[model samples]
Target: MNTRKILYQFGYRRCADQDRPSPARHPVIVVGAGPVGLCTAIDLAQRGVSVVLLDDADRIGEGSRGICYAKRTLEILDRLGVAKPCLEKGVTWKLGKVFQRDDQLYAFDLLPEDGHKMPAFINLQQYYLEHALVERAAELPHLDIRWRNKVIGLKRRNDGVTLTVETPEGSYDLDADWVVAADGARSALRGMLGLDFRGEVFEDRFLIADVKMKGDFPPERWFWFDPPFHDGRSALLHKQPDDVWRIDLQLGPDADAKAEQAPERVIPRIRQMLGHDAFTLEWVSVYTFQCRRLERFAHGRVVFAGDAAHQVSPFGARGANSGIQDAENLAWKLALVIRGEAPESLIETYDAERSAAADENIGHSTRSTDFIAPRSAQELRFRDAVLALARHAPFAKRMVNSGRLSMPSTYETPLSTPDADEWSGSVRLGAPLPDAPMRNGHDQTVWLLEALDGEETLIHVPNGGTPPAGRRVLVIGHDLIDQDGFFARRFDATPGSTYLIRPDQHLAARWRHTTPEAIERASRRLKGLDGEHA
Candidate 1:
């Protein structure tokens, strides 16, 4: 049979499991206990929903992948109460430098704004991040983390989902009101469902090595384009915690992995870059990857998060960060649905919002790849010329700085509700809504984000006087004001700038002035007000 017919047969088999299901009903069954799956399970458990987390691996942190975490990811961890431990355990870097040939000329600092709650970035391995999440999941009584258990089958129906899981001991049948497939790029769940993951795959390969080096290199991310000896390749030297420095070199199209790892092949690059600095190699691998994204994030009852939904080139560290954000967006919506507060359709927005963000990441990473990859002698020459220009030209410096990283995406969709008065620069929808300094209940001032911890916030923008009727209301620039800095810069509130922030801290809506009806409407949409909106 063809692939389509085989899939149709699998679908029928799983549907039979669903139709014959007994009266036992579980809250949620999440497949693949990677960081995304673990995060989803923990978030649901935190919301008081029972969750069963399953993974094929015998233990957490089995995979040696995903080493970088972005600022937005730290915020997601903060929401789950795991960020503090992650910070304590992980190494933080504040500066990044870009180099051309043998000379290093420019540097940029990724410092968190003064008094901001979160840092710019952290370098904790993906396994450590998963381990931290699992620890938190263990504390939540409603959550169950089952390792060495893999999903052999999945079926989606109007009622819910039925899953067939296999263990070393035996195969068992289970049913859930909802299912999330946080499996990686080659998602078995997405494949079984016949969903489309669309994008391009580059043919280039790279070598990443973690080494213990004796060098004068301070803790900073260093990138080299077209260095001596390697005519057309790129290199990254980043220091991880525990004195392990990660070195990445772009191997040529025909470079053999085994040959590249030989002490002769690896040591010279280190010596050339670090100027005869002594170093011992701990681990090495020749890794090749591509950038691609799913055509859709949701198909009926099944949803995809992390690598299952999108894959970006490792250039800008977008893959893991985007996946974590996918979890952040879907977790709350799933909780609301399981709690019977909103329609199951609310989960559909995850596909819409995240797919757009994935596309943006795809573009950014692809551009970074093109600059790093050398196609021909002329092309390599052009790249060298560009880097040489960046050495002396201010415009070239900015161009390289702009491509150094990825940030939170703006919600450009029509589905997104906009802020009242549009202020320029970084505060747009889909951007991070940072906290400004404001007063707390004790009359002592604190950051607005600090003051609004542990609960949802509804800022009331009273115009012509008459406050909206709600307990969650914070009267911005009136009873409450932001005077210190850019706290209310994005809101552009002159007295009346209302915003309803979700528990995940994204702005649900903003208005010049809010009514009881509008506030209730937005709150209900977020599952904060039961089914009142519907």
Candidate 2:
């Protein structure tokens, strides 16, 4: 009878007619309609703001949670216009393989760098990217969504939030200046604001399935490790396009009858990873989830996005691309503090830059599940001597392309700092500014992240500009002749590279030769403005 009375007996109650005066009032609301509250209510109704959204499930990607999408979450669904219908119904991959244990192999290609912006990942299905973000939040007419509702009480006064939803046309009382909680990971609003999520949990448990195979297997992403059968555990194998497949076993550590993972123990572990090659089933389950976070992600007019502010461990797809980059960094700073045009300490830098990119993506997904399942035995012989020097050099292929993971940044937070160019080598001020290629006025090619779609760009560079007035800046000029030389060796614009980005593109602050009074004090503390800026 603990854990705070079993999370207040899974609270979320609210009803018995409360003082109802709201249908709107700086109305924002949001709260879990999945895919980080429908991409934070279609990026706060494409910044016009006035959202409602809510949801207790009544349509919208019902389960089989977060399939996988990276490549910076398809460049943030191509900056919220829903990435060409999620790349024409996803399932594109360049390559991936990784097995180890007597049948060694280590492929991996994920092509990128040709009109950049996105490539290297996309295998869609988390209810088909929540059916294209609830069909672009049903063509936002100032967005209203609702469905089964259920925010069940929130309160927080002095300027906004009242919540206490419940609908099907019943309990109400909404009033909102803000309230987002892309709810999940047991986040009944971060357990009704008692906060503190913390982490570490892995007594092994996983089974996932979703068969219907016919293998020649090569739609990439394999990852085995001690697999000759489920006898030694670990197996992943995803490919879901039309031929469908998405396994993932590993029930070890006291596998208490996970409802007996049948189909004769999963078609003999897909006949030991494809020896007998016959397949056809569809879906299976057995989760045991754990990998936490949340020690704060704003809590006043209530806030918290994606897995209600962090969950990690779906190994490197970083929980719905870090909850759609925490709803594109809290939808345009909660639509410029509900249109009063900022200043609310810019929502305290969305809990200090997404709680420091959710603790560096939960310490790189708990070190990729402790370097592929190793909890001792001297950390599995130092992860098999770094996978036997990552199978022979090229500095372990750039250390497996720096653990092939992306999107998660920070610049020491308090809305980013570090400027006075002490520039030397490895500058990691809120990393992620990699794509390049250019030319878009009508001569073809593009990608300085396609002019950082829908808001907050300020790139500058090529002798960085003087922006900071209603912010937009994307200037990149420095003659690499606007489009080739591999995007001038990956975004080579050293005429004092600026960058500001953030609209879920990451890198929220940078400067090498920047000063229009430090871009008007980091654009008035990242557009949450209020006075001071010079």
Question: Model 2, stretches more than 4 Å misplaced?
Answer: 1-12, 16-27, 33-97, 100-222, 225-227, 230-234, 237-263, 267-315, 339-403, 406-422, 428-525, 528-534
lDDT of each: 0.72, 0.69
Task: Kindly give the stretch of ten consecutive residues in candidate 2 with the minimal lDDT sum.
Answer: 1-10
Predicted candidate 1, C-alpha RMSD: 6.7
User: Candidate 1 residues 1-534, lDDT tens each?
Assistant: 001111100011122223444634677888877788888888888888898887776654332357778777887788788999889988787788887667886888886466466778888766678778877887999987776667888878888887877776666788788888898987888878888767888878888777776656787778877667466567887777667677788886777867887777777877776676576776667777778877888877788888888888888778888888888778878887887867777776677778889888898987777778856678667666777788789887766632457577765544336455655534455455765667655567766665555356777655678766646767765556666646656456556766777766777677766577777676765553445435
Model number with the top lDDT: 1
Candidate 2 overall lDDT versus native: 0.69
Q: lDDT for model 1, on a 0 to 1 scale?
A: 0.72
